[model samples]
Target: MEALTLTTPALLFSAVSLILLAYTNRFLGYASLVRQLYEKLKANPDQVLLDQIMNLRKRLYLIKNMQLLGVASLMFCVLSMFLIYIEVFLPAAYAFGLGLLLLIISLLLSGWEIKISVRALDLHLNDMEHFSEDNS
Candidate 1:
C-alpha cells in the first residue's frame, strides 16, 4: 500500500461538501412537504394521505442517516489528514479507507431514497389516473 498523503484526504473535501449540500436541500424539501401534508391530514383524514405521510417518514429517516454518514465520512477524512500530518502512515491509510467506505455507504443509501421517491411519485400518478377515470 502506498503511503497516505494529506492531499489524498483533502481531495474528498469538495465532493463531500457538495454531497452534504445536496442532502441538506433534500431535507429542507421534505420538511416543507411534511408541513403541507400535516395541514392536509388535519383538515380531512384519508388513507392515501396517511400512506403518503408514512412514505415521507421513511424517506426522512433515510435522508437523516445519509447525512449522518456523510458527515462521519468527512470527519474520518479530516482525521486521516491529521494522522498523515503527524506522520502516522498506517493509521492514516486506515482512516482514509474508512472514509471512502463510509462515502460509498452514504451514496448507496441516497440511491435507496431515490428509489422510494420514485415509487411515491408513481403512486401519486396512479391516484391521478384513478381520479381522471372517475371524472370521465
Candidate 2:
C-alpha cells in the first residue's frame, strides 16, 4: 500500500479554506438575525427596539473589522503559499495559523453580538408585559 504525502503548502491551503468556510457560515447566520431584528423593529419601537438597533450597529462595526481581518489574513495566506515553494514550512504554518485565529475571533464576536440582541429583545418583552399589567 502506498501512502500519499501531503505537502506543506497543501496543508496550509486546506486549513485556510476551512476557516473561510466557517467564517462565511457565521456571516450568513448574522444576516438572518439582522433580518429578524428588522422585523421586530417594524412591529414597534420601544426602549428594547432602540437597544437592538444600537446593538446591531455595534455588531456591524465588528463585522467590518472581521471583514478587514479576513482580507488581511487571506493576503498572508497567499504569501505563505508562495513561500512554501521555497520549502519554508514554518512561516506558512504561522500565516495560516494567524488566519484561523482571526476567523475564531470573528466567530466569538458574532456570538457576543447575538447575546446582546437577545437581551435587548428580552428587556423589551418585559417592559411590554409590565405596561399591560399596570393597565389591569
Candidate 3:
C-alpha cells in the first residue's frame, strides 16, 4: 500500500474548486430572485416597483457574469487537478495560479455589480420622490 502525497498546488486547486461551486450556487439564487422581481413587475409596473425591477435587472446581469466566470474557473481547476494526479502536462503551480486569477476576476465583477445595483436603487428612490410630488 502506498500513501498519496498531495502537493500544495493540488490542495489549492481543491479549495478553489469547492469555493467556486459554492459561489455558483449563490449566484444562481440571485438569478432566481431577479426572475421573481421581474414577474412581480409584470403584474404591476408602478413607479416604485418599476424602479426595483430595473435595479434587479442590473444585479441579475452582474450575477450572471459572476456565475459564468465561477463555472469556468471550477472546470479549469478540476482539469488541472486531474492532470496533476496523472503527473502530466504543465506544473500544478500554474494551474493553481490560473484558478486563483479567475476567482479574482469573478470577485471584481461582483464588486462592480454591487456598485451598479446601489446606483440603480438610488435612481429608483429619486423616481419615488418625483411620483409622490406629482400626486401631491
Candidate 4:
C-alpha cells in the first residue's frame, strides 16, 4: 500500500471547515425560529404552535450532534497531520481514517435534519391548503 502523506489529511481541513460553517448557520437560524416561537406561544397557546416547538427541539438536537462530529473530524485531521510531520505514517493513517469516518457521520446527520425540516414545512403547506378549501 502507498504511504499516507501529510497532504492527504490536510485536504479534509477545508471541507470540514466549510461544513462547520454551514452547521453554525443552521444553528443561528434555529435560534431565531425558537425565539419567535416562544413569543407566539406566550401570546396565545395553541396545539399547532406547540407541535412546531417540539419539531424544532428535535432538529436542534440533530444540528448540535452534527456540529460536534464535524469538530471532532477537524481535530483528528490536525492530529493526523502532526503525526505525519513526526514521521509516524501508520498511526497517522489510522487517525486520518477515523477523521473521514466522523465526517461521513456528520454529513449523514445533516441530511437527516434537512429531511425533518422539509416535512415540517409540508405540514404548514397542508394546513394552508385545508384553510383554502374551507374558504371555498
Give the whole-model CA lDDT for all candidates, comma-separated.
0.95, 0.67, 0.70, 0.97
Span of ten consecutive residues with least summed lDDT in model 4: 5-14
After TM-score superposition, what is the CA distance of residue 87 in candidate 4 from its true location, in Å?
Answer: 0.9
Candidate 1: residue 71 lDDT (0-100): 99
Give a tens-digit lDDT track for model 1, residues 1-136: 5666788889996799899999999999999999999999999999999999999999999999999999999999999999999899899888889999999999999999999999999999999999999999
Error of 3 at 28 (Å): 5.2
Candidate 4 local lDDT, residue 107: 96
Query: What does the lDDT read for residue 79 in candidate 2?
Result: 67
At residue 21, candidate 1 shows an lDDT of: 100
Q: What tens-digit string does per-residue lDDT give for candidate 2 at 29-85?
A: 768877887898789767765766677678667666666666666676676676666
Q: Would you list the rank order by TM-score, best first?
A: 4, 1, 3, 2
lDDT of 4 by residue, 1-136 (tens): 9999878888999899999999999999999999999999999999999999999999999999999999999999999999999999889999999999999999999999999999999999999999999999
Candidates' TM-scores? Answer: 0.97, 0.57, 0.63, 0.97
Cα RMSD for candidates in order: 0.8, 5.5, 5.3, 0.8
Q: Best candidate per lDDT, number?
A: 4
Error of 2 at 27 (Å): 6.7
> Against the hidden true structure, what lDDT does model 2 obtain?
0.67
For model 2 the local lDDT of residue 110 reads 59
Model 2 TM-score, all chains together: 0.57
For candidate 3, the per-residue lDDT at 31 reads 74
* Order of models, best lDDT first: 4, 1, 3, 2
